[model samples]
Target: MDLHEVCDLIVDCEHKTAPTQAEGYPSIRTPNIGRGYFLLDGVNRVSEETYRSWTRRAEPKPGDLIMAREAPVGNVAMVPAGLRPCLGQRTLLIRPMRSKVFPRYLAYLLIGDQIQNIIHAMTNGVTVPHLNMKDVRSLPLPPLPPLPTQRKIAAILSAYDDLIENNLRRIKILEEMAQNLYREWFVKFRFPGWEKARFVDSPLGKIPEEWEVTTINKVTSYINRGVTPKYDASASSLVVNQKCIRDRKLNLSLARQHKSRVMDDKYVVFGDILINSTGVGTLGRVAQVYEDLNDVTVDTHVSIVRPSNGDGIDFLGLALIDLEPHFESLGAGATGQTELRRDRIGETEIVLPPVKMRKQFSEKVTSLRKLVLNLAARNETLRRTRDLLLPKLISGEVDVSELDIAIPEEAA
Candidate 1:
């Protein structure tokens, strides 16, 4: 059956322009759609009044599948319950015919390679490819299994997703705890025995009398950008890009495989800090490598900062977070692409607490950091398992009917 046959309503957002963040309701755009989840952060907002006015014909409801129609073409995410989001331009809302098709089932089908390939072929655009609504509605959908089987498949996939989501939440909490401690001690100067610590003036600002103000160059043993990756289909090495660093975390999803000859010196190792060195909005972003990434290297746009001695990784990350504004100010460009001045970054002065104190702070957060890394690794494994199972289950190649898989109570 064509998608239009199984879907009750297939509509794109109204062509009307959405208001800026200051004057809008929570609006979702192409970038807001991840593989199977909606990324709320950095999503634009539209006025509630405007949303109601434009969505009069078809309002986005919980369980409706939202797919990017342009600038990306096939990314899909389901609207969660209780979100009255205004569908932004270049996005499509799909309401499945509940009796014949489950919403989650349809969402999973859309992301499967078969449907994705069909959508990709029908997409048309010169610089930025897009899917035409007419073409999308006519796109052929594979024959679906019985509703019970559909539910079972969705339940199994969602279980993995739920575990991954739970781990992500825990990782976020752990990260916040570590960062808060860093701020309280290093930024707010509220470390233990703070009452007796004397104050001293430095080039950057007033800091503890015992702290030394130093440039990043003084603490780092080596600093250099990686080579421009030569992408090879057969390559086993992964190359990190600017997009890989988000919210001070490394997202391997953004990394791509490269065929270039391996250079041991160019490899980003555990404890190495990566900084996006080019492009506006992405420049100056930093993330520490907490895991042992084998055969992984970064592209030229990313600068690798290795601590002189092995202990400054956490301190440098926190310092960079605090001095992000300073780094942003040093960005030089006019064509919407800003490049960070490497010299300025090296010369950026930061307050350095005593070695013993820094070590103490690291020890305090060491377990928290370990937890974050462990959770991230677990999520990666879960993701691989889901991806491996998805196509087989969706294509009916693997039958779950006889399997003794138990669905979570909430999911059931």
Candidate 2:
């Protein structure tokens, strides 16, 4: 069956103009649509009046599938219940014929390898690839099973996604808790026994009298960027790039395979801090390695920062994050692409609290970080399991009708 036949409506957003940030209703764009999920943050907005005007014919509702039509073609995500977002440019809205096809089932099918390959083949453009609505409507779709079987398949797939989502929520909470603690101890100067603590003027403004303002180079033993190796799809080691660092967290999904053999020192380890040292919007972003990320190397655009005393990894990461604006300001460029020199970053000053206090802070956040790591690891496993199962289930290669798996309340 053609995709257009199964869908009640297939429409892209009429408003092709970029929306201003933080000023109006949430505008769903290509960036906001992940593979089978929506990224809640970082989406731009348009005025409510604009949204109402633009969405009169293509109003997005819960259960509708949103797909990227350009930039990165074919990536899809389902609109969650209660979200009344207006679509942004280069995004397509897909409303499934509920009587003929389950929305979640259609969404899963769209993400399967078969449909994605079709999308890739149909996409057009050399510089900025895009899909034509005419081609998108005529794309082939596999024969869907009966409604009950479709529901079963969706239920099975959604279980893994639900657990992953739950873990992500927990990870966010843990991160916020750690950040708040950092703010309390360092930013607000509200550490224990602070009533009697004295203050001293420092280059970074007034800090605790006992604290020392030190350059970044003083506390780091090793600092260097990795080389851009020739890429090999079958390589063992993954190469981390600037995109790997997002929202102060390391997203390994963006990392690609290392092309050639590299030195042991080039490999990332636990306690190492990574900085995106080049590019316009990506420069100065920092992320810390919490575990010995196995067989991973960073690209030239990313600089690795290791502490001198082999301690204070947590403190250094948080401090760098707090001072990100300063580093960003140091970025120099003639063209739009900015670059942060190693020397400038090395000379950047940061408040150094007492060694005991820094150690205490690290120890305090150990459990929270451990939880985050475990949850992240679990999500990775869940993602792998889902990927393996998705194509088979959606293509009817594996029969799930006979299997009696209870649908979780969340899926219900």
Candidate 3:
């Protein structure tokens, strides 16, 4: 545990490359919901030309640890496959001084919440924070024992990360299925019926005789835009920022709840869909507030929609997600960060089947949504458990001598 005597491995994480797409440059973005090692913050994918543009881009080797160091700080991910090629912005890449330790072990050290406090100390500027090579060199790290011990800890944590990634992968598949269904049945006008399907006029523009166009307001009477504080309460409300909508799930883990104004049950309720009205490339992303959330409220940047007594609330969530193509087309305007006309939320035009069919769709989607949520929740829990286990095992705090995790061949 005496880390002071050990020489710390250090490298300046690269500034992210330009946003423009180039033939050689493919981008790497933080995975959704901080679910996998691939995620640190919002997703980023850069073209090869742009990846080369960063003055300090560091090519991580396999087993190297990558940490997001600025703007949004302390998100950590590992380079499992070894560094083939990756470019990052405001991140630190630590190449393990293998003579003394395993790179994976060092990665676990950087991720521990306790060590992050140490990492934060090295950033020079508070407003626009950054860490140079010198700063990274000075980063305090605990001296870990041997590779086997380090492997033990890394294994414990990696278990969670691995499971979380699995869940994310599953969700992606399911959501893709849902989206494809939407496109086929709704967009492409493909249905079980036939080639002779008839069209009819309805409230929501022209639609199939069996379909009806409707406004969301008719779906929910209690819906309205979210509340913003007259007085800022950094302590109280983490207004459901657009970032909260990810992985086709709403993550309020980052939402800060502060006290400013009164919040009623009406302001937020379970199954209530919070629509992101603003954010770069996130305009109109809908988050379904599933069970397990406390009394959380969103901000003006998002609009809250509640289903009517007869409407299938969960169905609405699916419908919105399925209609993402439509929402993207409508477009939002923002000078800097993207902002959309949220007031038109209830007014969004949607085509649906007859009342009975709509109800059936709602029920099926609700059931499927619950299954996805449960699986996702389980995945998150597993990943969290593993994340908690990593540092202790890696740091030699919680012993894991009995856990039989094979060391990578190169690591050995």
Candidate 4:
């Protein structure tokens, strides 16, 4: 069946960008559209008036699927309850016909590999792939089973998603806990025995007398940008690029394989901090390695900042992570030519606590970061399991009719 037949409404977004403001309804752009859920963090907001004007054609509601039509072309995410999001550029709103197809089921099916490949194949553009509205409307879908079966399948997928979402929330909380700890101890000078500690004027500001202000180069054993990689699909070594570092987290899934062998020092390790070292928008983004990586290195656009010692491994990463905004300000050159130079990064100032305090901070922060890594690994496993099951369930190759599955209300 054609996508249009299963959907009651398929509306295109405003051709131009919406005017964004400090607050109002969120504008759901292509970047905010994840595989099956909206990635709302840092999403643009518009004034209520602009929201009304932009959504005049069709306002996105809960259960509606928003699919990217360009600049990625096929990524889709469903609007959840409580979000009043308006469509942004190169996005289309999909309203599935509830009686014919389950909304969540259709969303999962569209993001399935089969439909995603079909979407990419139908795209048109020399540099950036895009989908024409006509092609999108006429996109073929696999034969759907009965509505009950569709709900059952969606419920099974949703279970995985629900767990993943829960872990995501916990990860966010854990990250905040670590950040708050850093701010309290380092920034706010509220560390243990801080009240009775002597203060002195320093380059960064007044600090505990025992603490010292030091440059990144003085503390790190190595600080350098990676080499330009020769990409190869068959290669065993994965190279991290600017895209792999975001929101203080390293997503290795975005890393690509490199054809050539890298030097021993070039390989990323468990405590190393990876910073996006090139491009205007992405420059200065930082992420620390939480798990042991094998055959993984970084590209020229990323810099590896390895701590000098293991005693305060988390301290240096957390400090660098906190300096993300400052690093962004340090980008050199104009617009697209901007780069985070190795020298500038090395010269960046950071406050160093006493060895005892450093180790204490490491002990606390490492525990929280370890939890984040574990949760992330669990999410990876859930995603893999769900992805493996997605196509079969969508294509009806794996029967759900015989199984007694309790479908949730959201799936209904």
Candidate 5:
């Protein structure tokens, strides 16, 4: 069946960018549209007036799906019950016809391998892959099961999504706690025993008595990016690129296999901090390697920063993360493309707290960071399991009809 046949209404977004504010209704841009779910972290906000103006065609409701039509081209995410969001540029709001097809089921179907492949095929021969209104309406869907079966399949998948969402929330909270502590102690100069600590003037600013304002080069064992990889389909080693580092976390699944030889220092270690060293928007983003990554090397676009000593690796990692904005500003080049030079990063100023004080901070934040990493690993596992079931359930190859499942009220 055609997508238009299943959807009651498919509204295109306001062509112009909506004016954003500090806080208001979230504007669901293409970047926020993750597969089968929304990624709302750092989403743009618009005033109530702009939200009304932008959503004049049809306001996105709880069950509607927001799909990207360009840049990425076909990723889709369903709007949850609580979020009141307006469409952003190059996006579409799809409202499924409840009588014809279940909303969540259709969302799952759209992100499924078959539908995604079909969507990609339509974008072929285009300068920038995008869907015109006609093509979007004409996009085909695989044969759907009966409404009851559809609900059951959606419920089965929703269970996994529910778990993943829960973990994601927990991860967010854990990360905030970790970063907050770092800010309080280091940034605000409120670390324990601050009252008795004598103040001193430094190049960066005022600091505790014995603290040193140092450069990244002075304290790191190694500071350089990996060599460009010779990509081969059957390669065993993985290459971590800018895409692999996001939201201050390292996602190994995004890493691609590389056939190139990796030097000893080029390979990322457990405590190494990876920074996106090139490109306008991506440069200066940082993520710490949590687990042991075997035979994994980063690309030229990513620089590896390994600490000189074990005592302050945790402190150094969090400190570097806090300097992301500073690093971003330091990028040199034209507006479109910017590069964070190795020397610039090395010469970047960092305030080093006393050794004992840093060790104490590290002990506290390390526990929180570990919790965050554990939850992230759990989410990865859940995602893999859910992906394995998606195709089978959507295709009706694995019969879910006989298996009793409770359909959520939202889907009903």
Candidate 6:
């Protein structure tokens, strides 16, 4: 089947509008408000004010094609429902006649390498690359399948998304539980024998009788800083940096390679937690090195901790990640850019429980983290399969109609 270029399907498109209801009015300044993204995937929401400011004249519905046009282009995302009227100045809205193409299918087609390459080509500018709308519509769109088939493919992909979303929600619950426990036991002084508890004057002020206030350095036998010699494309080493840690987990999807670095057995493995002792935004961010951690090389921004005989890695990691906001405030200097120094991080104190309590806490949090890791691994696999199948289905490289999406018998 011949691919149908977007140019042929055009019913209408609009760009220029009356400045203050026609008749020249003073130009109103439009702020980006960090509310712009072109090649976005899996973004859930945006601010109502930003949405209103974007779509003052008209509101866009869900399933509309949104393309970034200004300040460097090649960004796209489906306009989700329940959004206040939002418009994009540097973005293009490609609405297909439903009689011709399914909007969701078209949105699916624009993901992965095909759209990535297209965006790269459309980018034009020195400082900031802007996308040309003329070239955007000129780009070819594949001949689409019938409505039922389009919906089927979408359903198959959506199933994977549903599972992934559920797993994300589960992870959130696990983190919250851990934090709530910490707050009750530590901050609110709600141990089993709180009324009978006695305070001790340790290095960390007034900790409970059962608690030992100690610096994190004592909990770990080896505290070392990692390095990346240089960035290299061909190298196979997984180089982790400050940005790799997000929401208390290590995101290895964005993991890159270093030229060459020291490779060792103690490098990174299951349940190893790394802390960002100092950086602009990532100071105090904690990353647990699990799943796909092999031959991993880290950089200076990270501080690696190997738990001593008394502590468990998972317990400490969860604790650190849970208290990241507090750690950031304590470590950060009131300046233009926030930073947490390595020495200052050591100076900052935390109340430590006994070995038995540490292990018990680790058992709960690690089980949760383990569940997250397993789910994450599955999500990664699903993502890769979906990405691989996406282009094939869109470009007609594979017959999507012939594909079988096997739902369980009960589900069916």
Query: Best candidate, TM-score-wise?
Result: 4
lDDT pick, better of 2 and 5: 5
Candidate 2 ranges with C-alpha deviation above 4 Å = 124-127, 261-264, 402-412
Q: Which scores higher on TM-score, 1 or 2?
A: 2
Clash number for each model: 4, 1, 23, 0, 0, 9
Error of 6 at 246 (Å): 1.5
Task: Write model 2 residue lDDT over 1-412, tens digit each, in one string.
Answer: 8999988999977856755657777888887888899886667878878888879878988889888988668989898877778888898889999889989989999989999988887764456778878878888998889988888999999989999999999999999889889989988989887889999888878999999999999999888888777888898779999989978889998899866677888888888888988977788888888887788989899988888775588888888877777877888987567898888989988788998998999889889988998999999999999999999998888998788877544321
TM-score of each: 0.91, 0.94, 0.82, 0.97, 0.95, 0.75
lDDT string, candidate 1, 216-283, tens digits: 89998768888888997687889999999877888987799888875788898888888888888888
Question: lDDT at 341 for candidate 3?
Answer: 60
Question: In candidate 4, how many Å is residue 238 off?
Answer: 0.8
Model 5 segments beyond 4 Å from truth? 125-127
Q: lDDT (CA) for every model shown?
A: 0.83, 0.86, 0.61, 0.90, 0.89, 0.60
Candidate 6, 244-350: lDDT as tens digits:
77667788766778776574733776656677766456677777665545688677767777666635665566566666777677556555456566566565567
lDDT of 3 by residue, 345-368 (tens): 667877766666556556555555
Hey, what RMSD does candidate 3 come out at?
Answer: 4.1
Q: In candidate 5, what residue range of length 10 has the lowest lDDT sum?
A: 403-412
Off by over 4 Å in 6: 1-51, 65-75, 81-96, 124-130, 191-196, 199-206, 263-266, 269-271, 277-279, 290-292, 330-339, 402-412
**Best candidate, lDDT-wise?**
4
**Colliding residue pairs in candidate 1:** 24-46, 24-47, 25-46, 25-47
